[model samples]
Target: MTDSRRSSISSIKSDVKSDIESPELPLDQKHFGNTLDQKAQAQSKEQPSEETPSTIPNGGLVAWLQVLSGFMCFMSAWGMVNGFGVFQDFYSSTLIPDVSNSDISWIGSIQAFLLCSATVFAGPIYDHGHPRLLVMFGSVLVVFGMMMTSLCSEYWQLMLAQGLCVGFGAGCLFLPSIAIIPSYFTTKKAVAMGIAASGSSFGGVIFPIIFRRLEPRIGFGWATRAIGFISLTSLLIPCFCIKARAFPKTRRKLLDFAAFKEPAYALFSLASFVGFVGLYVPFFYISTYAKDVSGLEDTLSFYMLPIMSAGSIAGRIIPGLVADKVGALNVLGVCNLCASILGFCWIAIHHTAGGLIVWALLYGALSGAFVSLQPTTVASIT
Candidate 1:
């Protein structure tokens, strides 16, 4: 780089540096350096930098760390929530035996509902740059709620502790991880989400088996406490590492109900709402259904959720790469259709363990794909 060329580029300022990458000026003594300097000086005055900081370090150590934190966050939040089927099964038989099946199901239902919906509110807060505190607070509620669950024997007590407290904590902690992801990635957002969301798939695979193995050995209270301790450990990294980058100023409206004005967004929201209606149906009822109608033994019935979740591991992974190539909405549409078809087929698999296992595999993969792709699709749209 010649002195003249360097002087031309450096004189413009930080905004110019951000808006354009200055070319390496040649050191040729004759034509090249002087000509480039004249052009750079003229171009600098013509184009004004608009104060947009190009801070998206798309691939770097910090960015990968963000992805790592997101993985742990998803594991702790949605992955933890995915284990609710185990709790539902356990609670119905032991802690709250008198409670109606429908009533017991509500605990998991509400937890799943809150785990996703709270994101609507938490997202806005995250855009404002307070993820660490929000996560820490949520971690406390979740761990404390778990500790409290060990003492609760009544239906209402369990409802408030496990359903509300744990659910609320999970909900609050969930969005920041997902919401921060787009800030660091653009072209590979779907794949990053797939990897991060796979945490939940693993959670689903592990937590249920733990609950089943632990419950008989340690009883409900201590088993739940053990799970809580695990959650505490899973949450520590995300609580410290997840940070938002490149979001707009916080003065923007928190809840933009006006986004419904866009027909595409409105329909997308409706589709998501419709999807959620059935999303938890299988996870919440697998054990109960296996026990009640499939006539499976208690030990076998408990494995249904674990099997479904294991299938979901693939669901979370493969569709992401596919979405990256063909488009997120395309993959989501296909998976949602598969899920709908599998859901209808679910009615045919009664009293046969083989049939139930096949259904679990198909539905679990479809559901996992849907869950993993939805966030990427939302960000991709418009």
Candidate 2:
């Protein structure tokens, strides 16, 4: 069945040029033939006179602006998700002291889970060419959710506000930021995404510091609202900058259940899903865990999140640069193994300040690539 399906790719000798110039892809006869969209694009490039010239600019002033817009979008959405540790640690000690760690952890869990899973639905809508609307509605939901969060006093209230509202809002915004880039660039995809994905680490580093400073001066409610104001500004860029093609030549179905038929895609998707089960554990708990084990004052413990994020800034950018030269999957697979090793190390070293600090930095640096390269990994496969 696979050989029959791929008979056409073997006849297309022109693809060898791309294969030679680009980083190597994992081999399979059916995939080498190319997926439907890739085959269509290859044919167009091969026979431009018979088809319309592609208006999807690869790299230009406009393309770079979209990259900047995507960066800001990621900074606010995933950045806020990373900063959840500060809020989780604070709410447990001050706002909802009666709640169990497991219970408080769910707020961050739900937010992370929703933000990651949202791609399933959002991917199709972007294909439909409503990029601006998605960005606008997502902006509203994100800002409003943060504003509402300032007034919550109970666990359920916080969950609905931050976990449900903010999570979904971030999901809505996050998917578009990711989706719009491919509409603009191909050869530069790895670098463009790397720069945008770096925003999460930037946000992670900055927001924790923001919370640590403002929490005391303005109090908790206003401190959150202050973050909301920052998100409002960040969310605006993508709304105006990122755009869809004026005339979409093909429309894909919203969901492709048949994807389960392919072994590589199925297994990779499953691995990506399972990776998340443990993915955000440290991001959610590390700061509080550091305080409890090390007996540090509030001033010192909060810096741990920022430190982890600082290391992540390097992790996201450097691997992306290397992936373009080598292969994204090659980098992604190695990064995931390193991240898993760091996860095990998390279990043993909670007793000392230096140990906790060192572990957070190492783990953050390794894990950042895991977070950034997920989409690029899937892109390589399918």
Candidate 3:
């Protein structure tokens, strides 16, 4: 009649059926079998499908705190990488002045490359229930890398410290930061991820400004150490606050070679590769371009990357809200197209400081949307 009564009756029927089908036994053994059945039923209720409404908190203090922790991860990891433009400018003109721009660019390139490539290993590790371990280890590497970069005076040293060390450390942080959000909130995944991803934009803006203002006064080494100290402080938040929810029984593999056989996976991978190749070109060289072509003052030239990064903060947030309604994949596609068009438009902005600023802001917004939506889209299809 009532719900509880019906459940009890159904459970009883399930036990009786099980006992009848199972091998005949004494009364004590039958009672033990029924107890085991009840325990199994309880376990099943506790571990419901991810899509089940009761399983996902969707909104709560704990869930939102996870978002905050993820935000910190984005800031310390990708944020530092995003600010490599400042380093690029410094390395080309001041630090190792003899190195060609192409050679100097490799430091940032390797850093970015490792940030993505390390995920192949990090993802499987995270799924194996070592999130806190990964975050802690990554935090150490990032702070350590920045500290090492501060002491470096040569190209090879810079590459090892800033490029390999920081990049690999960030790769460790990036996967767990993005992957854990889906476990807490299914309905709000896009918005939550957007908020978390905006940390990089904030980091992007803050790191460049810190470097720009402090580098001249304190010198590059101390300025970089200050950045490292800031990263250490910010990373502590994620290290403590993030709580990894246990996923369903599906096991994660280090590499799913069969994933490439699917058209969607193959196409998405290709698109991401192409998008990234063009994306950082503007971010890395915008300051140098402004100085050489528009003859802007060094102070004004250095601010270009910060301006672009500042613009991305909004782009990172607004698109997620939109994607929650329209779809992450659709929003990502549109943003990619817009970003590409703006990349071509860079050729025409060499004449005016005002033009370059406007272009940077617009491009930042579109590219930010693309970056924020990328993981959300992948989570959806997978």
TM-score of each: 0.84, 0.83, 0.88
lDDT of 1 by residue, 198-279 (tens): 8888888888888788988999888888888888998898877877665553334678677788888889989898888888
Candidate 2 off by > 4 Å:
1-56, 246-250
Residue 315, candidate 2: alpha-carbon lDDT: 80
Total clashing pairs for each candidate: 0, 0, 0
Candidate rank order under TM-score: 3, 1, 2
lDDT of each: 0.82, 0.82, 0.89
lDDT of 1: 0.82
Over the stretch 1-382, how does candidate 3's per-residue lDDT look in tens digits?
A: 8999999999999999998898578999999989999999997866645556578889899999989988999998889877889999989998999999989999988998999999888877876778988898899999999999999999999999999999999998898888888788877989999999999999999999998899889999999999999989988988898788774466567785777888887888888988788678778898998998889998899899999999899899999999999999999989888888888888988888899999999998999987789988987776
Candidate with top TM-score is 3
Tens digits of per-residue lDDT for model 2, 1-382: 5996577676565577677787576678558667877978986754423222365577898888888988888887889888889998988899999999899999989988888777677767776777778788878988999999999999999999999888887888888777767667766777788888889889998888888899889998999999899999888788888775442455568885777888889999888889889877888887887788767777778888888888888888788888878888999889889889888887677767788888888878878888777767777888
Highest lDDT, which number? 3
Candidate 3 yields a Cα-based lDDT of 0.89
Model 3 regions lying over 4 Å from their true place: 1-51
Selected candidate, larger TM-score, 1 vs 2: 1
